[model samples]
Target: MNALSDPEPQRSIDVAAVSALDEPNRRRLYDYVSGRGGPATRDEASDALQIPRQTAAFHLDKLADVGLLDVEFERRTGRSGPGAGRPAKLYRRAERDIRVNLPERSYELAGQLLAQAVDEAESSGESPRTVLARLASQLGHDIGHQTGGSDRQLLETLERCGYEPRVEADDIALVNCPFHKLARTHRQLVCGMNLHLVDGLVTAAECPQRHARLDPRDGYCCVRIGTTTD
Candidate 1:
């Protein structure tokens, strides 16, 4: 699935998973397991790291519990059935990409959107900017649809997209821009895309009275959601 359509649980970083690495032993064990090309048993990790088997097992299990590691069971002796000995528990790095950012950023999502826009523009002989606006709008529409397409849920949907919406009188101002860094360097392109994105969201949510426009205020998103009168 596209990054935008990924299940919320998969796209978001697990705070507990990041916290598990704060422990020195657990961090070291995680690094060792991640560096290994294949799964490592507790005994192998303890021997390589010069730690007690029990300690290694505890750290490894903690990592697995937090979804930082994937666990499996197998017989190392290349045998199965009775008398072949019990299966050894093994640990390997989880395939999920875990990222933690203060205030939460969606640079990866922005990258994917820009890349797709470029590809589509090249194939269809359309301006990259034009294609980008369309893509962003469509994505916003999908998001609004997913949130039940109601005016009341607009703030919730925007928050989930990292917009950090704030209500001021009749207008809703976005306090955080998910593509803040990108917008600084490519203000026109990023802000235009942001405007179309919110436009699509407002349209799909059936909030016809609300309009998204480029207000470009300091310390806020370039696009502001205001009523038709504004």
Candidate 2:
């Protein structure tokens, strides 16, 4: 499915999983279990972390509850059928990437969108850069349309997407770049895509008085919204 056509659903990280790491003991247990690369039993966790068996079990359960760890029941004693004892609970790191960023950035979403665009372009024998710019613009237009066709609404949409828009004398500057890491490595490509994105937002919002320009600064996004020279 075209990500640009889909509704921009805000992706939420597991806060409870992050908060669970605040506990020193639980953090230690998590570190140990995660490094092992294999499912760890409560007893193994207790021995490795030097915590009581019951304590390890409790913290491990908490990790599982918040989806930081995956839990499964198994019989490691090599006894299965007949009179085998109860299955032991094993814990392993969940197959999840947890990221917590201030202001709720959606870099992963943007990255996925870009990746999909590139893949589609490759399959269709089209210019990847052209396809990427088009996809980014459509996404920005969709977001702006959802926000309402106004300059204020466009800025709000950008802020929500982690541009960190700040109003200057006669222009709006982006204090934070949502694709900062990618922009550093792929400056021209990412910046070009960002420029088209902001332009599409301005167009969709019917704000012809202001247009997006590529004005690179030391610690800000490359794209800026300013009064049109025309």
Candidate 3:
């Protein structure tokens, strides 16, 4: 088995950062700063965009406050000590990536797991599918362990992972597949991985009464967590 680090926590779109760009002046300033290839000063932005310096400053500060732009202070004149004037505040594109999706999807997470499986298989001379199942299982185990080993935790974990789990009596049915598109195109591969992942989750969570199995149905995830009978 190959060692893998836990996936980075998912980040939802920052509404405030996005809303700040709704203003025309602020949006223009953001575009200018992002395209400038370097930090921009208020004077530079005002002159380039033909906006008033005060207007540019207000919008720039707004952008920075909302995290749409990063702020830095530097003496552009290359001077030192008290003899030099106060460092000018400059604006640049923020390093954070922002994305908005309706209903929320985690294609990136699926992609990362697939890529890791391929890399590990190539290096270890193992079957790609085999490696993928192992990787997915390990990820599920990690998620279960982190969320605490309980039935409630398992459901919460699935929900957080975009599974949209629905409870029916003692069984849980998933209404959404985070890797929907991928699963549609590569049903067997993706579904197999999904089963192993969910199975691992159930095992790690110590859900003795739950059993994960392939119960493919229309408009539902391929894997279903059903109640186990003694």
Candidate No. with top TM-score: 1
Candidate 3 local lDDT, 130-225, one digit each (tens): 999999999888876776656788889888887778786677887667777788889999999999888888888887788899988765778889
**Model 1: lowest-lDDT 10 consecutive positions:** 95-104
- What value does the lDDT take at residue 219 in candidate 3? 53
lDDT of 1 at 143: 72
Q: Where is model 2 poorest over a 10-residue stretch in terms of lDDT?
A: 4-13
RMSD of each: 17.5, 16.0, 18.2
The sequence of per-residue lDDT tens digits that candidate 2 reaches over residues 1-230 is 57555543223336777788899999988777654536899999999878899999999999898777889999878988988999999998665545565323567777887898889898998998989988989977886676665668777887777777877778888876767777888999989988988888877877777899999976467998998872
Instruction: Give me the overall lDDT of model 2.
Output: 0.79
Give me the candidate number with maximum lDDT.
1
Query: Scored by CA lDDT, what does every candidate get?
Result: 0.83, 0.79, 0.81
TM-score of each: 0.56, 0.55, 0.55
Colliding residue pairs in candidate 3: none
In model 2, what is the error at residue 146, expressed in angstroms?
A: 2.0
Over all chains combined, what TM-score does candidate 2 have? 0.55
Q: RMSD of candidate 1 to the true fold?
A: 17.5
